[model samples]
Target: MEAMYAFFMDTAGMDEMAAHITVAVIMATIMFIVMALCAIIFTWMERKVAGFLQSRYGPMRTGRWHGWAQAVADMLKILGKEDIIPAEADKPYFIFAPLLVLLGSLLAWAAIPWAPGFVAADLDLGLFYIFAVTSLVVLGILMAGWASNNKWALYGAARGAAQMVSYEIPLLLATIPVVLYTGSLNTQDIVIAQQGGVLNWFVFRDPFLFIAFWMYFIASIAETNRGPFDMPETESELVAGYHTEYTGMRFAFFFLAEYANLFLVSMIAVMVFLGGWWSPIPGLDFAPAACFVVKGVLMVFLNMWVRWTLPRVRVDQLMHLCWKVMIPVTLVCVVGAGIWMMASGAVG
Candidate 1:
């Protein structure tokens, strides 16, 4: 036990091995708890927002005028669900895929710094870690699809894989401007560079980047599998896409992951193009970091707004929008940002 303890201490860079173990457990618990909280909030918000948009009362019976406890009631119902497992299903993978998706999404939150020095891990490759961890989730979706052995599942998974892969390329490229200017792969470093104010945001550094922000936002929406790019789960089409066979707690896991991922990607966009935790206007050194929270929450609401507002695109149109339109435009913007940086002496 002493030898095993020493080995982990060396690897975790901890003088005490128990601390390393404790940290991991705490981080995981925090992730689950926070994600659950966000999911509850999202459910309530979605109903109210939908009602507002449609000019009707959404949920008036349960709690207040809008039934805020609806999510809690729904959770109780989901927990009571029978937890069905198909006889034809590839049992283990079918049972495990939703957990994997949820796990991956929750873990990525470690790298996100919501407020001053509040990140879980301050790794130098924070941004890279996020990108790497998130891409594996597509494989989890594919697992759910294939394991279900349903044709609609297969089609949805295939489309999701193709769509995610195509959109990721532009999503990655559009980040070049943020990283190039910040000159660090650390997510916090990127946020810090934008802290001075609106003028100081990397997004406003040049005209190319100004255009790049919109491009990145669109690409990120597709990456998150939100509309108008939600072809995978088109109820009129695939019937819940990759999670077609999932039910009860398993299906609930996927829903939790989706909302968490939606918020994560929105936060990333906030950090990159919207100055992260900084207030919109400059010169407010006394501003509370909670202001950044307000900004990020607003950004998430904007995403939910778009989802409810827009119709899902055709699969082919989705691909065409990414490859033909967004890709080339982003490429030009990336190169233009670089050139402008050089010519204007922003880079040496």
Candidate 2:
């Protein structure tokens, strides 16, 4: 019968859809696992790097050659700790906050374009997608602090909301040069524009764009809650910041998301300004992508290096840097880049 054929085709299509969904889920799970592994490695490496800077051994007993397994040890301890919630806190929002914060971290990787034809969902609006996803993270932090029913948590939330929102302006403006040059908002298009080599990259295009690169990089650090900008969890002032009331895995989720966000922002820096996954010098066309990965990793290590060497800046100083210095500079860069693009007949 006609009805039987329709049902049979519907069932077959459903099965195919299920298979695609399963693959997407598995790929996402792998990305999550990879983020966790990177977190563990970075934490241990941070300690070791700090020790070397301070001239002391950081975690020698936890693993072979300077405590590599220290992260694993810390992982077990964090996992075993009792999960606690404040008696007066809003139970639903408090429970939802960390997961949502971490969700932003996971959502970012979907459009990163790790390799050619290897993105989760190569949306045409990749740059804007990351911006939108990350904007939600501040909301989650605000929720966590407000729901906790604690003054310090609220203060930290307020600070995070203000800082993130402020820095994003410069970050958004600085990326304009690269976007204008690429003529497309898609991440893949940006990468393809730099295909000729390092010289063809935006950073090498002119003096103004090079300045924009640093502008974007600094704002990105502040946006991701990294050091010098991590006023959110300032122990001396606000205790553990917004998540002060959290413990166990919930606490760990925030930590994981913080580090993963760190990685995401760094990769963003690479993609937008540093030619992303392309070799810094061009040539060897066959291996250009390897260059991009190396540059990105180097940037990640640079972030870790900066985090260990510098102390955290005050909130006022952070805001000053964002509003007074970074913003104006980014505005100039945008103008300069626009002028150059028009003169060169590069604009449509």
Cα error of candidate 2 at position 64, Å: 1.5
| TM-scores of all predicted structures | 0.92, 0.91
Clashing pairs in 1: none
Error of 2 at 84 (Å): 1.1
Candidate 2, residue 82: lDDT: 96
Candidate no. 1 TM-score: 0.92
- For all candidates in order, the CA lDDT equals 0.82, 0.84
Candidate 2, residue 305: CA error in Å? 2.5
Tens-digit lDDT string for candidate 2 (12-112): 55465565665577668878997898688778877877788788988898767767788999999999999899999999999999999999888988888
Q: What clash pairs does model 2 have?
A: 277-292, 278-292
Cα lDDT of model 1 by residue, 1-348, tens digit = 234455567766676747557666776687678789888888888778878877887877777656988888988899899898888999999988887787678778888877666677767988778877888778888888999999888888888889988998888888888788889988789888887778888778799888888888888788878888988787788888888888899989988988898878878887778888888777774653576657767877888788888888888899889989999999998889889989999894
